[model samples]
Target: MTAFVLVSGPFTGGEVWREVAARLEESGAEVYPATLTGLGERREAGGPDTGLETHIEDVVRLIDGVEGTELVIVGHDYGIHPVLGAADRRPERIARIVYLDAGLPQDGDAAVQLVPDEEVRRRLLDPADRDGGTGWIDPPAADGWQRWGSTAGLSEEALARLTGLASPQPSATFTQPLRLSGALATVPTSGIFCTESGMSIAKLEGLMTLGMPQFKALADPRVSFFDLDTGHWPMLSRPDELAELLLGAAAGEGHRLAAAPAQELPGYLRPFVLDVPEQTRERIGRVDLYLPADPDGAGAAGANPADAAGANPVDAAGANLAGAAGAAGAADTAAAPRPAVLFVHGGPVPETVRPTPRDWTTYVGYGRYAASQGVIGATLDHRLHSLADYPLAAADVAEAVELLRADPRVDGDRIALWFFSGGGPLSADWLSAPPSWLRCLAVTYPILAPLPGWQGVDSRFRPVDALAGAGRLPVVLTRVGLEVTEIAATVEEFVAAAEARGTDLQVIDVPHGHHGFDTVDPTDESRAAVEQAVRSVLGHL
Candidate 1:
């Protein structure tokens, strides 16, 4: 037999778990639904002096009194704090810890820090701003319950029952930092994500790919995940399903996320589809320059001069290539300075990947393809190795642009910037204040806005907002039909903003395409789309 302990979130109590508890009891298991101090029937027993420690003690006492050898503690939302604190002190008694639509907190993380609203978090963290200075945070009214979390799938009666049982929570509970002894690190754990709340197993897996330390830690064998297709309050919205999931969690049965492979390249690094004539390559500082071939075949061999002994070219243009058939005519007229296209590869790419984005087949292919069209092509390796590294990445991009302009072989006054994937946001800086020399801007499958939980992203990184000031700059946007929902939403938002601002934007739709369609899909449509976009960009230049 297993004993299940249910801890409710803020303003609610054991009563909120009644539906789920009944289902669990019917399965011949012991159940204990905890009502913390200052909530539900215990509302009158708490005041300003009540803090997180008091609630933690309440759970610790419950754990001590429960008569069972197999114990599973379930924590929901704000209730996770007391549950974690108690579990740390009684790890031996707990067989599993199930996180029910809750935030992952580390040592010294206060509950208020998890609040998304700026004003609410500020008030909760400041004792002086608490309810009448009594150190109490009032619960939301029945009609205002959505402010807490999504109320989807709940009936009118369920909402009334919830509000009727709600009570004020102590401000200290929100402000007090949670401490851990790391005892529960090895305990088997399950995460039940509420999909309606904008969290799901897929999103968690997506986050893991970003190479964040905290998300990477979730690859532990002891951790499993489940998704609930309902709102945050599953007890009221889907009690039977919640009970069954809890049972499965106790049995250590759920989807396990495999740790990222040690040496496998991510999907974005796949080879590009289009086969274009190779151009001569020159290695500059953090940038790879591809120069077109001379008409007289002076430098027709596609080899890097720098690679040969003492063969440094005076200018980036001195390098040469054998132009493709159609491009020869343009190269014949290239005695004047040549226009340039700088391809910015997208990232948050892990620093561990070999031959970074600049060397990857896709980017190298694009650079060579650009050069074959009678223009200089440049690709760079920027430092967007993590979500928080945006500022540094933006600075690296700025520096690369200057380097491209300084090259005597390239026409600095006729340059176009083409951004891909995560590199799309870097275009916001240029769009906000288009320079006279910047002939055009292009993006393909770009992330125009920050995704959920992209903390510390600068406000200036919003491309949709920047469009209002983009003026008459020619903008080319290539959108795929089957992009991830989060990324697709940002693209739609950017398009709408562009239309609203009457910006000179040209949208190229790939109706049957997916993100990274150029490399992954490889159909004729993909090749055609790539060719069309490249032509449109060059036309602007």
Candidate 2:
């Protein structure tokens, strides 16, 4: 029997391939399904912060465990990037390639950008897609999965596992184009486009024509193409037929697959922002700031991508504030002078041009619940340690603080702050030395790496010397069940570390079955507990 390796796309796990695998198995072919870093239970230490190389390693590792020269890579959705890298690295092992209704990656674009149906593709993208240096689209819900993915055959377990997959894909893949040294040409590549009835016919047509012209252009020698009158998910829609097509291609039963039908072009401009360099007065230093206008903003709001009824962030907020304000192109509400919560978003150098209504845990769906809390949420784009000469991300935070204080609505005196992941530590450093008036802090999953090795600075959780002046602030340490299994040993570990340092710390292990407890829509119990945590901190503030 021939051995095949099927790789599932984003928001899915190896189990998603079961139906297809079972079908192939019934037909006498052995199948090994591969899941990427953050897809299924596979969501590991590496996320967007981990790049294309990580994904390549993941596939290679899976390949090493399986013994077969008859290896065929069948990549679906986001899985295509790593599969190419795998084939690029291990051409000898691959017998043939099958792209199951997936986009062909380019040297300079990520999965999201690779698709040509700009308007239709953007229709699914959301404001939660923050720029984490890797150009990642925040992982959306099942609804999002359906937007670009064919989900006909996804199992209950496969769909259930998605809720646990946390962290927006680290953005690097989207920003950094793959550097294919022409390795893809060596493999006999095939694109399988599933033709669905209710599917976006016009959109699929655009994907073939404008979205993937290279596939069409490569009409001759190396690459092969085919179309199926099936749903988005062939494995579920027509698994046996799809399996036969793959096996037949492997056995050379048909000629090179023909290109699917093409349709008219669709208009689009992904809402992305660029980080142009900005220099300080007196030529102090040059820093990059992505003015959060548009990923490619057209000066004004043209149309709301999310439906006015379903999953629209504007409507989700119960008021289309961003929509209305954007529609009128109203000036940004002048920032307040005080009562501010300095928010330093993830990524060392941030391009969080998009905003999420909910916190890290999307337990309750994406809601702007943070802004509604009567706090002046200050989200800033900070340059990373690499970009800054002195490695002072705090400087950028401080400057942003000043900018916020400069606003009439902000109260600089009674400042309360919140930081998630490494942003907490960076927030602490800025609060310790600066002239800004910061009173309380709530840091979630603070990164403690820099403090230990930072020469000339006392980062060993030192007290009394500078930042806090021997005064302790209420600290909340949170950890999800998964983080303990993966990295930290529950939220108590952080609390214990803080206690040993003589710093007061309150720990909450947010009794959620999954990780990323802070994102919105945490399961009912976990979600309520997180809200309680936030409320307790608010009381302290």
TM-scores of the candidates in the order shown: 0.64, 0.41
**Candidate number achieving the greatest TM-score relative to the actual structure:** 1
True lDDT of residue 289, candidate 1: 77
Worst lDDT run of 10 residues, candidate 2, spans 279-288
Task: Please report, in order, the local distance difference test score of every candidate based on alpha carbons.
Answer: 0.81, 0.49
Q: Which ranges of candidate 2 are over 4 A from the true structure? A: 115-139, 150-168, 197-217, 255-541
Q: In candidate 1, what residue range of length 10 has the lowest lDDT sum? A: 318-327
Per-residue accuracy of model 1 over 134-207 as CA lDDT, tens digit each: 77888888887776777887889999988888888988888788899999988999999888877798987765
Model 2 clashing-pair count: 37
